[model samples]
Target: MSEFAFEVALCALLERERDEIIARQLGASVHGRRIMDIVCVEPGPDFAKRVAITPHEIPDAAIESRAGVGQARYYRNCFDMHPDRARSVAERAIEIGFFERVRQGSRLYVRQTARYPDEWFGKLVGIENKPDLAVPGDLELQLRKDVSLGVFDEVILATESYVTGAHLNRIPDEVGVWRFRPETGGLEVVREPTALDPAASGVDIVDEYAGRTDMRVATAAEKARLRRRMAERAYGKGWRSFDLPPCVHGAAKTVSGADGIPYCEWKESVVNPAEECGPACPGYEPADPPEIDIEAVRDRRTPWVANPKGPRTQSGLDRFL
Candidate 1:
């Protein structure tokens, strides 16, 4: 079906109720605006009986169901209802912030922050916000402007890497001396061990590591880009139980089926940290190596991922079959 056709089908399916299902599917994209709720485009002849929506303004949908592919009714509703548009109905999905093109990656991940509520993110996968890592923006805007507070009093410190131009460190604690610049909107935390205070216990600044100090500053856009990239990196997954996805760099073994066809290994998790299943499947066991002919495995995968926006579905289907 065309994107518009699928959207109309989805709307018809959700005409009465189905928001919980919608929220369940499209909730985790972090970096850009995704259609969390139905955006009712301006009504027209094509939208007569349905609740037409354009998820994040992408021609494709923000959510799909494993129950069935291209099954519009099975997946519908905004998982992250934009606060500004929280009160809106399915008919007005647009006008909240539907940029046609997003600069970030495929998925939209909500920024991990203490301020994010369970209602907004439904209990994020990881509670910790990577310590004091900051998104690219004006960190210390001086809420009062005139009522200056000590740089040490600031709750979080956001900075850049001295060598890699990457997000390497977050101090997250007490340091003896620090500086904040109003003109450049930058922060510097210093740990000189001279005058013997709380952090000066070892007092080995000049004696131990003299030139070990490092500093870095990155532009706001650069920091935002960095955070976006980090969010996409899959990590800390419990390999067993089939409840979590494997790391992007992880390798999984494949095998041939009775029909002599090889298939790539794939697993889906409904819960988390799945319990060890014992001798049979062994919850965390590495996938089995392919039992198929070597040439069969080599010839299976297409050069690229299947693109829905691409044309010639009939030819594509034949290649896979």
Candidate 2:
């Protein structure tokens, strides 16, 4: 099976096996984003753990470096692109301590006190997936980097390859190893990973560049900000957060198959629902169902707040429940 298929199947199994878990999201070595195949987040009340799902305009360096202080207009304009979210975020900024009300004057000025809560998420686990360890590409270096980064509480490598002493020797000792079974959606722990001290160890924000680059240690505050940002993203957009392709029947109904993957009765196969589906697909049929709801919800923080102009929406809490 293709890696994408394996990833999809694994996610399907994880969604069920780890239902209590708050969120899961896919990641890659993307710019400014955390590096991990799959990020599993465990929610908590800590200021650092909580993340606002509302798509508020992030303050630029000029505003953020100003010691969390900014004018009401500053925030308003920041959210100008997303006018619908402006009021909620403006109010939420104060409610969540991101901003402090200076005065509700003619301009309604406010100061940015905090960008994100100090502790909202409790534990974060980074998982690296490799169906065939024998064809590993820079696996050792990647695992080593993760161990040194110490951003996640634990780093685990999940693979469908057979476990052997030789394979274990090639992997980092600090990294956890999991033997995955795609057929049964089973995972067996071959090695347990050790927790790292974030403050003491420090994390590497950027990966090695030009084969030889300086590794800067990230401060606790920097790490906190990154964690908050990632958690907010995870909460707002789960790995399964994708628009389903409309079928000839109006809506493409999705279900988990015996192999722990999305099964489409229309396609009579394990369909990749993450991608677009329509007339382009081989299984296209035009039999629209009556009373079908066609909508897409991007933000899931405040469902009560109506967005008649936009697609349907719901709260992340509601999704979790």
Candidate 3:
């Protein structure tokens, strides 16, 4: 039953009957990040939570050849460099929130703002989770590298078995076939996927492996700017942002069950919050991890849709690309 509990029970049945925006694992982080066992997304406008991508710490083509470009260019022509590498890349982009320090009049900028979206995204899809399609591992070289990297506009495969016909002649007829059940959350579909364009098909910014050093060759405007930075990082990371596991008897341990899932209150059931929970789990020990709050952890694991660009913020990327 583990494929991480059938991928968190098909991400709790696609977050209770699909509304969209889901992320689990995510794309490659160079050469080691093929995560993707679920991706969904499809609401529209959230540009990674309204845009804010600031850090250009030097080299917007060398500040667009000395500040003569657009977006009202100035911020010392993109972070007036060499003050210790632009203050160490603006202090590591303001400690990872992605740059912020601003002033304007006396001049002191380091912005990375983002609220871009009149329609920043819609229809991304991707899913792969195979709860035993008769154990097909490289499943036809991973659905032919997801239909030759069409940055997912449909790539599905899901499964929990029971939909044979020789398993659709071993996958990849343009990949698409669900089945999932997770005891009654259901999913079916069985085949109906084929949309991918990625600006006239061109993606795989590197993943064929074999003495690779983060390979490259991406253009269709670099796969539409890395498909909008992987849909703005799957609309601000979801699919249960991993990292859980902590408990072998250190109390406060783990336990959420029902639809909130997550349970391993000392190996009693469901665990794998990304690879079998904690201390290098041999059913680890020492625990203390379930206090759960912040509005019941945003109504149990947020599923997107909270001001997704409602009261007119800005930048709908020129009306959805």
Please report the candidate that would top TM-score against the real structure.
Answer: 2
TM-score of 2: 0.63
TM-score of 1: 0.17
Off by over 4 Å in 1: 1-212, 231-307, 310-321
Q: How does each model score on TM-score?
A: 0.17, 0.63, 0.33
lDDT of 2 by residue, 1-321 (tens): 545456656665665666323334544222234456777666455322133322332332222433344444444555534644654566666654456666555544566654444454567777887888878487777777677667678888888988899888988788899988876777899999988665543646355567674466766666555555655556544554444434553343333331223344665555555563566777767543323222231122122121222212233433422
Q: Between the candidate structures 1 and 2, which one is better when assessed by lDDT?
A: 2
lDDT (CA) per prediction: 0.22, 0.55, 0.57
* Residue 44 Cα positional deviation in candidate 3, in Å, after optimal superposition: 25
lDDT of 3 by residue, 1-321 (tens): 778767877776676666555667677222223556788767565434343332111222222223221233334555555655765555554454444566677755665433234354677777888887676477666666666666677888888889877888777777888888776666789788877776664545345566653444445665555555665666555665654555643222222222445667567666665566656767576666655432344234444332334223334333322
Question: Candidate 2: which stretches are off by over 4 Å?
Answer: 19-34, 46-117, 201-214, 246-268, 273-321
By TM-score rank, best first, the candidates go: 2, 3, 1
Model 3 lDDT at residue 47: 39
For model 3, give the 10-residue run with minimal summed lDDT. 55-64
Error of 2 at 285 (Å): 6.6
